[model samples]
Target: MELKPIKTRKIYEEIVEQIRELVVRGELKPGDKLPSERDLVERLKVSRASIREALSALEMMGLLEVRSGEGTFMRRLKPESVIAPLAWMLSIEKGTVQELLEVRKILEVQAAKLAAQRAQADDLRELEDALENMRQEIVNPELGGEKADLQFHYAITRATDNKILILIMDAISDMMQQMLKTSREKLYQGKYTPNILYSEHAQIYEAIKRKDPKQASEYILEHLSGVEEELNSHIE
Candidate 1:
């Protein structure tokens, strides 16, 4: 109920905070439609632009879903959604890209190790499907291939069966997607051929399929390091 008239210069941010607070406090439960934009502007005494901006921000955070011809509704937000504010900050901060990649390497290395030991038939099928998607998309632009690459990594993480690790991965999924896209584009533009990329992923898949945790971890690390080198080469 701290939803008062806006007094701050960052009116949109204040509005976002108040609405988010209400949702967090259970004042706005899941599937509860919010007031119209005009009504919200009138109630908060803020400009229409500010209200729109606030709602858009909340939508990006997965807190609100805006339906066409219908009002916005509160969503049952995930832990990843709650971490979005931090994720945004990390995305733009200096030197954060390297830090993010390093963290990804650490988490994914462990994930790969665990996947090697615990991956069931379903998990193996998922990984194979993802890899096949990547292979099929190699002749096309990197967009579809990049998406499949992400799916492959996510499958490995799911194979780990660690909820906390999965949540952490979800929290940084956006940034990770961007990084993969950039690295892949750079690799394609440079020395890497489509076949080379396919080979790298296939090697990793083979290691995991063999249930060799050590080999899986090593292959994934090497693949990531190669990607890091490609990115660094562009910077230099």
Candidate 2:
């Protein structure tokens, strides 16, 4: 039989996805033991290196655990458990903050457009509540926007009824907070007023409520653009 060529980069991912599918399909439940490395090496029709690399990644993702004295075992999927370390590692990494923000702006603007199409009464109320929090926090003793800013965006993400948007937002919350801190420090105290930001948010919220994607996007873009220009002017 002719050997099928397996590319190294994709082989690892192919092996990883195969194992994940097994668990997802309930062929390997949590706590079920995976076959030995030798067994996998034979069954997978791939190299030992590919097997090892795949297993190592799975272990890092908390999808599997390897015991030296024993063997590898399937693990439960838990988003709650993964978030803390993910947040911490992401928070300290350079370049991720702005990159993450740019990603969020794209999603959120589109999400706002979608929300305008789908928003219900309760969703409108939720956005209103978030806006209220921003109002209350304007005189907040805290120097930077914290819970108020997150609550506002989170409400919009929820209104979109999109799991992907919500998950991405949650994963990057830590970095967003840090970026908020940096941006706030530079521009929070001067050249702009809290009332100005509050008004911008109100405009976005209203546009979403009315199912106007264009205006919703415009409001967020205007708001973000101001901050972006300011950040650019001061970039070191």
Candidate 3:
């Protein structure tokens, strides 16, 4: 006898779907702690591995948060909640990094310009501090560079004193780091990376130091556009 077609899914994947459905359906609100592992084990009738895998998927989607030594809680959903899915999609969709960077390029360049025009003395000091940290990281090539780089971008946005702008840019911090790593990879392939970025970053710092909005904006556009061009050249 011929066998009928079988329908199947990885057990964890199905579990993940159910949990996400509950969350989207409002059965699980933001900040709600999920049931304990043992409770889920009995409810889902799945192995520990399956349960763990489902939880991992949910965590990656920003639908849930797991605190060390504490229970998992749901995160506040909105645009921020969408970031995880966007990031995962970008990873799967071929040739989208350049587009992602372009978006950041536009947002950040505008923020940089505004920051320069609006920044007060205290803002300038913060920006200078971040810049100095970046320089030290470059010179020493320590693992601390990522934090410094993030602070550098943040300083510019903070200088703008636009709470919304600062928040939005902060949300995309992960994406920025991802894109920068990719850009650096492209540059590394051509032996054109490390020194080049350090100098360009310095130029932006200099413009900010002078509080020249026009020059800061121009330099930011030029720098980010160059990165986009260099990446698209090969991947396209």
TM-score of each: 0.65, 0.70, 0.58
Pull out the clashing pairs in model 1.
Answer: none
Q: What's the CA error at residue 42 for candidate 1, in Å?
A: 26
List residue ranges in candidate 3 displaced over 4 A: 1-95, 142-146
Which of candidates 2 and 3 is the stronger one according to TM-score? Answer: 2
**Each model's lDDT:** 0.82, 0.74, 0.72
Q: What shift in Å separates residue 175 of candidate 3 from its native position after superposition?
A: 1.4
lDDT of 1: 0.82
lDDT tens digits by residue: candidate 2, 1-236: 11233546578766765775675566888789988888777777888988898788778777788877998987776865444334434544556545766777788888788888888888899889878877876877454455677778888888888876677778787667777766776765556567777888899998997789899988887877777766766764
lDDT for 128 in candidate 1 is: 97
TM-score of 3: 0.58
Best by TM-score: 2
Task: Single out the weakest 10-residue window by summed lDDT for candidate 3.
Answer: 1-10
From the highest lDDT down, the ranking of the candidates is: 1, 2, 3
CA lDDT of 18 in candidate 3? 69
Clashes of each: 0, 1, 0
Q: In model 2, how large is the Cα lDDT of residue 138?
A: 81
lDDT at residue 198 of model 3 (Cα atoms): 62
